[model samples]
Target: MTTPQQPYQAPSAEAFLMGGGGAPTAKFPAFGTTVSGRVTERPTVEQQRDIKTGDKKFWSDGNPMMQLVVTVQTDQRDTSIEDDDGRRRLFVKGQIQKVIADAVRAVGAPGLEVGGILSVTYTHDGTPSGPGMSPPKQYTAQYTAAATAMLHASDPAAASPQYAAAPPQQYAPPAPAQQQYAPAPQQYAAPPAPAPAPVAQQHNPAVAALQAQQQAQAAAAPPPF
Candidate 1:
């Protein structure tokens, strides 16, 4: 009968990133929730493999993806934090998991081209060999200056002012060559006046006379007899 092997109690990537023992760790922030923590170290490939294989179990899956234990001295009210639930700090396990998944997707699997997974390792001991890079202690001044310039350029307000202040130089389109055609003379036409109404000919003069006589007689009569 084979005895069950004792579970490994190796230091967690988080613990290592937080600095072995006694050192404080940074906080990372999560979307929607008010949790902030610094990712002291990202999980390495070997570490991930071990965790999946049950060789390691540093954190519980159901817990927040972006979870980090409170530092010995974490400020819950810091402006960097999203919410102030009164805890030393907020841990967003879900957001962290998404970020990890996205990273894996981007990096893709080993031996496949494109998208590289990020890992952090303080010390190398009995860990499986894989493509990995350690965290940088400090960045170069040139890189910092370049990054700052890029951020400044990315600002809408800053970019707007630069564009507004220096409008693009206008380049007037060349005038089309004028044709040599002669000018046409202007001609005006006067409108004709309306014709007067025509008077009836004397063919009905007798009838007109009779009608005039009747009118005169009627005018001469005062009231009905």
Candidate 2:
């Protein structure tokens, strides 16, 4: 007899992102709060709802949501690790991840490395997709100089290279010019020969004497064989 293949079930938010310590907190921080630090944990897939509707709607990854957990030490930090509290874990996606990952890359990182540091603020797109009226809010990532500046300054690495995407090729703007005509080789008259320098009169006494002396010496010198 063959055993049946079971359907995929998503882990709870408490089990989200590897279920490290416990499920994630009940809520993410308010919008626009800057969060910055190295990514303590790389991105992972977890279901959005603890209870699977059995319909794998998005990405076909079984409603697997992409999450990258980072530790923020800046004032934007919602919690403290040193104090035994959890760090702020930003769940990034298109609007937010595009902005933040771009900014992180702009700041000297080849890309968003695991250990590589990052700092970004976030806001909700206000689109909640869940069962009841008070469904969970979807958030978009935001980038700021004040928060991410240090991240740019930092040089961190990840356990393995994954998130760092290849830099886009930047070609020069093709030199904004139409077919060059080269001014048609500007031709002008040569302005006369400067009067040929007045044909300097070498018929002077000293020159004449020197010539005479040289000629006499030549006459006196024996001819070559």
Best by lDDT: 2
**Would you give me the overall lDDT of model 2?**
0.49
Tens digits of lDDT, candidate 1, 44-161: 2222214266442234633212233322222345555444322332121333434434443543432211112122112212333455843322111001122333466588866567
- Mark the regions of model 2 whose C-alpha exceeds 4 Å error after superposition: 1-31, 45-47, 50-83, 123-225
Least accurate stretch of 10 residues (summed lDDT) in model 2?
190-199
lDDT of 2 by residue, 1-225 (tens): 232333675554444755564423324467665556555444454433333674323444434454444443333323443343445555555455567666655655554555555556545545556666554444433333334544544534333345475789988777777876655655544333322222354657676677667667766665442
Runs in model 1 lying further than 4 Å from the true structure? 1-9, 12-31, 34-40, 44-99, 106-167, 171-225
Candidate models: Cα lDDT each = 0.37, 0.49
